[model samples]
Target: MATITAVVNLDLPGPTISRHVYGHFAEHLGRCIYGGFWVGEDSDVPNVRGIRRDVVDALRALGIPNLRWPGGCFADDYHWEDGIGPRDQRPRMVNSHWGDVVEDNSFGTHEFMDLCELLGADAYISGNIGSGSVREMSDWIEYLTRADDSPMATLRRANGRDEPWKVPFWGLGNEAWGCGGNLRVEQFASLARQYATYTRDHADNRVYRIAAGAHEDDYHWTETLMRSFDPLDRDDRPATPFQAVSLHYYTRTGSWAEKGKATEFSTDEWYLALSRASWMEELVARHSTVMDRYDPAKKVGLVVDEWGTWWDVEPGTNPGFLYQQNTLRDALVASVHLDAFHRHADRVVMANIAQTVNVLQAMILTDPESGALVLTPTYHVFEMNRGHHDAAALDVHLKGAPEKEVDGRTLGLVSASASTRGDSALVSLSNLDADTAHTVTLDLRGRDVVGHRARVLTAPELAAHNTASAPETVAPRDHDDVRLRDGRLEIDLPAHSYVTLELTLSPTPSQPLVPR
Candidate 1:
């Protein structure tokens, strides 16, 4: 085993890691909507007005901050009016993006809002800009948030909901450079400003409008969008059209033509996945640098609304469904990305995994035939790291950390991130090596540790994953090999594992940490 030393500077706190950074996405793709979250009210599966009960309960336990809805490529094609009226009266449309399946419009505005309420999560709605009009987007906002007797508000009342729903986040479009519309960055930036002008805030429900941003390392797309913010309105004030920009990245071991299998992969692929996941740090840094030239105060956020592992579909699953198995490798990929998000908390305000249930890198997977719900290994990581939500980020510096060579490039073998909330602190660690364990010595500075507890999630094999038959195959368990001595903490992390240490700290004179 290798030994590594890390320093946790608790006193040198950074920005508050927004709880929205722990957000989730639920698109109208494949089983993600129909069988994953919504089973008809008359079905045998237990549910709360068509929303799956087990799914909601499982997500609620993770303290899910927000959920982005009706998206990916579907949001641009979706018309809000088709889903508002009675279920039987609603129109059916072909879901061209996912599968050539028919969308019954069963799970629409009301259903998504109800699911968010059931999980105690905020709604992040993505509007249609590719195939819909500006008035349509504006009316949808009024329909959801207006308190007065506007036309859209009256329609919302007739549909059953009396009070206006609070929509905290609104996405202008999904991917304007591709499925959203094959438009250039300049075209989309101009449209974003025009559409955002009418996405009015109604009553007490304020919307954080997020414009669709670049993919991967497209720095030019980000520059074009940020340049549009230079123009001032009539009052000589900054005409910032959007409060944030969206970035989408997926950890794929293979090319887009052949996104490797979810479960079947060699050791080289494992290292490659983590290597790609770690690239998030560079992406955020470069993008934020571009945004800094425009808004030096860092008021705008970089919302990674869609990110996760995107492997090929399971053997028997439909290609368009994107129903892939979540293995221990996928869990590590999530940890690496989350650590990047934590490190750049100042600019990376919010991030939603590609999906929540029964889709690409889902937190929960469901069996359509048997209605068996199994929490993915990725889900356990989110539940374990929930303490980092809305906490002040603590700088963690590591020395002598091991590294592995993959495809002629070196990949870090260990990952760590820390945060403090009140009298408690959380440190998340991951060991990317698949064969050897490592011992990590944490130097705790500026805080006296009163108590500590640890938990680890790992499997017997790298490809081990959860199934309906054996749900806890790769779940978190209490780890007792953690000790604290003389202001130093030591933990034995197993190979291909994720661990979280929670420490109870003695109060200090430095200011009380406030959550954003």
Candidate 2:
């Protein structure tokens, strides 16, 4: 096995990796909301107020910090009022965006809030801007956050929710350049300002309004949105029209018209998928540079609200549902993207993997026929890296790391990122090589390590996945091929694997230590 060297600068701590960076997304598309998270109050599956219990419990275990809801493309066409009041009395409409199915409005504002509560996650609601008016959006915010005897507040109470829900993260729209209405960047920016103006903060709930931003490397779109921020107010401070902007990206091996399969892929495609996911680092850096010119203080965050692997729908499934099987390849994609997020934690404040359950790169897949819930390989990555949430990012420098060429692009065979919290630190690593095991050595600096533990997630093949009957097919297992010797940490990382190391660090000494 080839050996690689890396350095973990324990003293050089960076920005706090926001817990929100490990966020999740649940769109109305596919079975993500209906059967995945919401199985109704009468279903045989154990649930709490119609929300799936198994799903919530599994996600809570990962410490999911926030959840973006309502839609991907479906948000723009969704009318909030239609989902309120009595479930049966609520208006039913055709969900034009996904599968052209009828939406009964059963899982609406209250239901979403309840789900968030159960998982102990913050609500990141995407508003309807494509077909709804400013008044409608304003009233919805009022109804959700208002505390006093206001008009919208009164209406909310009448609907059975006596107290308003706290909505911290509010989205202006989703993908305005496409499914969210084909408006120019300038037009969308203007609309964002107008709509955000009325999204008031009520009671103790302060909403962080996020405007729909660019798609992929649309630097111009981000520039336009940043330029549209309201000029300095009377106090000579920038007006808070929106706290952050959003960007959506997905790892697809082929064009939109022909996304590759979720399973049954060749080795070339595996490297291709990883190479594409690695591009997130470039995207974050480029976008952050643009934002730096406008907001030098970095007060504004870049929320990657929609991101993950998007493959062709499973066979016999509705194409619009976006249901795809998750594999070890998907887990590595998540690891690489998360490592990028950690490296750029200063700017990339929040990132939500698309369709958290039963849709594109889902954490859990529920069988509709058997009512069985299976945790995907990608889910293991999230659970393993939960320690990085709200932790100080540690700089990790690699040397002699292996690399491979894929489709005319260089693909790094090893990926690593580290973060320190309290007296413990987490180091997550991924081995992209399919057939080669690597021995990795880390030169730990600035702190004394008291102990260590490690785990590995990998399978014999890249296409290995979890199913209802065999949920542990691609799960994590305790790794014993790791040890801390002298000051260096050595780890034996197997091929097609994701590993995390938990290090117990001693407190900083008041004086410098002499050479032992």
Deviation of model 1 at 93, angstroms = 0.7
Scanning candidate 1 in windows of ten residues, the lowest lDDT window is 507-516
Runs of candidate 2 with Cα error greater than 4 angstroms are 231-235, 508-516
lDDT of 2 by residue, 218-327 (tens): 99999999988765233577567999999999999999999999998999899999999998989999999999888877888999999999999999999988999999
In TM-score terms, candidate 2 sits at 0.97
| Candidate 1 runs further than 4 Å off | 231-236, 508-516
lDDT of 1 by residue, 26-84 (tens): 99998999999999899899999988899999999999999999998999999999998
- CA shift at 294, candidate 2, in angstroms? 0.9
- The CA lDDT at 96 in model 1 is 95
- Model 1, residue pairs in steric clash: none
RMSD of 2: 2.3
lDDT of each: 0.91, 0.91
Count steric clashes of candidate 2: 0
